[model samples]
Target: MSAPDRQSSFGIFQALRIRQHLVVMAIAFAAFALQAWLFQHRLDAPVPPILTDFNDYHVVGRMVAAGRAIETYDWPTLKLEQIVQTRNWSFMPWAYPPPFTMLVGLLGLLPIWAAYLLFMAVTWLLFYAAMVRLAGRATIPALFVILPSLIINGKGGQAGFLSAAFIGWFLVFLRERSAKAGWPLGAMIFKPHLAAGIGLLALIERRWGAMVRAVVLIAASFAVATLVLGVEIWPAFQKGTSTASEYLWTGFYPLERMLTVFAALHRFGVPAVAAMVVHLTCAAALVLAVALAWWRKARTETVFALTVCVCLMTSPYTYDYDGVALGLAYAMVLPRFVARAGRYELPIAVLLSWIATSNYLWSGLRQYWYGVPIITHEMQLWTISPIALAALGALVIVVLRRPARPDAPWLRAYSWMAGRKPG
Candidate 1:
């Protein structure tokens, strides 16, 4: 083809890609809108959620209004029972301290439908903004936000985007300067499980100021909850956590067993005390791994990637939609991986990305449990459950053992071709 003809074709292709992207974005928003409407109108229809889980936000909103605390034994009887009986505004109880409950409550002030809209939009924007910041470019921001796992979070009304943004910001802050790390790290405590892996990273780096800031922020949030809701809420929340595993076990969700270091032992009939010991030991070892990695000045993005793996490896209930964070981390690091290692690593990256987001769906379907939503099954195993935990653990081990020298290109190539990276 002539040069002008080739240029014309390339321009047309670029235009088509842009149009396709916008169409997808519109469809995503429309899906969220439709889901929100269904949730508002037919929450009692007995049909399960499609690809997301947003019940927690609704429950928390109501609990805040009624000034009720989450109860240990009364898991299934939250607001649904009352709504089923009387169609009243009564909602299920919350399981968090007042600060968290209040935050959701504040979000709830806008009608639930409105809250859902705002949640989707804000999360999408924050996720994109943070990704752009991480990549030092806006080129793939929309692509990052529209990822399947992320859309799942938006569907369920979960705060995965918020978690991603905070974690990304924390990483960016640390990279920019150790001094400013404390504030963003503090913001992270809002979703404790999501931040747990990164917190260990902070501790490993010995950023005392960051550690202090995190502690202070946590204390402040708790203090605010106590003051606003009463001291009874903390004890109530603790009780809720203590008994959460029991309720989960009774549920049909996959990996009802505590699947992390803490829950893994518990699942195998380990005694509670022994399980706690194992959990603490594993947690400590993870912290040490991150600290060692930091000491060696591993790449900044690697720290974030490993932090994500830590979540999978350690958290008790890492859900599949929460795996969106893993995807985000991968997006940030993939370019660097490709730039350093090239096409050899491409296939592994594709496979890992697929499993990271959809493994649960495929696993569940393969088991012939077609009755359940693919996203739900995905939540069970693809999230932070054992399979994900195993995958992430293996990834981290690879990261730690891989060659560190620049001249060791062969080792890097081998590792990449082998489809391994630091978590």
Candidate 2:
């Protein structure tokens, strides 16, 4: 073909791709609109219940704002505090550490409904914007790719988006090999366990600068928490953890809502001790695999994708909303996923996403199911733990035939990528 002919052909291809993505973005916007509708007009009750994790957050915020911060750990007092919003419905004991209490306490500055909407909306924006900064040219298509996870998170008032934003920016900084990578990890101190992968990656790669900064930020969080809530809040937080664990163990908290390896095994009738042991074993293996992947210098996209899965698998208490990170993981590897050049790619991608995101996020659905020996709930079975392992394995196979290249230009905005102009 002549040079002019080739240039014209390429222009046409670009136009078609842009058109496709625009179509996808439209569908994503529609889905988000539907989610807002559901949140506003509750079908199950005249109003959305305070049964979500937000109840604990709202009540604790009220306590802290009302100078009853210490009573947040005291259930009798906390339950009475919840009566204002949660009423006589079930209460979710505060399971977070003191640092997170500061965040929840800020929510008390507004009414419960207002706080719920604002918190969810802000975190949702954070997650989307953080991912877009990394997604770059593919931002439009990526929106639809992660739509289900976004819908699930916005449907309820949970911290899923906060965690997703952390993971998203953490990857964005890591792609640039910047010290800022650790800053996000430090901010995740409220749910530090979910950040296991980043810590492991830093140690394996000898990223001392990033690690040190992360430690400093963590210490700062503790200092701020102490300054705001007082040193005694630490002991109260410790006691609260015990109470929360007991409640989860005694079945006051639904095991079916938990998406951990232990929860899956326990649902299938495994003893709690045995299930926990298996979960720990799986987590340890994931750490080793992710470390090895980084050590051998696999593609950064592959390694980071694996790391996202590793983080979820290692976190024992991550719930459905937390699946947002899993969706982000899929987006990271989109250009390189299996069947990339075949007609099956998009369909296969959607299937994998559904398996990762699940379908039990809505309310009023049957919460229980029976299958002879496997009397279990819907999403509680696939468990983010096993699903993460599955994703890790699938990623490895997809890249098995391709030469390992330490390249990830799709993760744009890395200052190094575009001549290091320093964005």
Q: Give the candidate number with the greatest lDDT.
A: 2
Candidate 1 regions off by >4 Å? 1-28, 44-52, 69-94, 137-146, 178-180, 248-253, 256-286, 340-345, 363-423
In model 1, the clashing pairs are: 52-156, 53-156, 54-156, 79-92, 318-384, 319-383, 320-383, 395-423
TM-score of each prediction:
0.71, 0.79
Query: lDDT tens digits, residues 1-423, model 1?
Result: 797986776666556545644665688688878867866665545554322235556555655665654431145565453443335432223344456765776664566677788787787677656665765432243244226565556656777777777777677777676656776677776667667776777776677887788778878887887777777777667766556655444333444322355444554556656766877777667666666767888877666766766765566555556666665567545544433432434444445555546534555564566564242323433233454545644654454454444443344433332223311
What 10-residue stretch in candidate 1 is worst by lDDT?
Answer: 414-423
Q: What TM-score does candidate 2 get on C-alpha atoms? A: 0.79
lDDT of 2 by residue, 291-404 (tens): 888888988877887888777778666666687777566666664543232344345555556555554442224333332322233334334435543664564466545653
How big is the positional error of residue 263 in model 1, measured in Å on the Cα after superposition? 7.0
Clashing pairs for model 2 are 61-105
Whole-model Cα lDDT per candidate?
Answer: 0.58, 0.67
Error of 1 at 385 (Å): 6.5
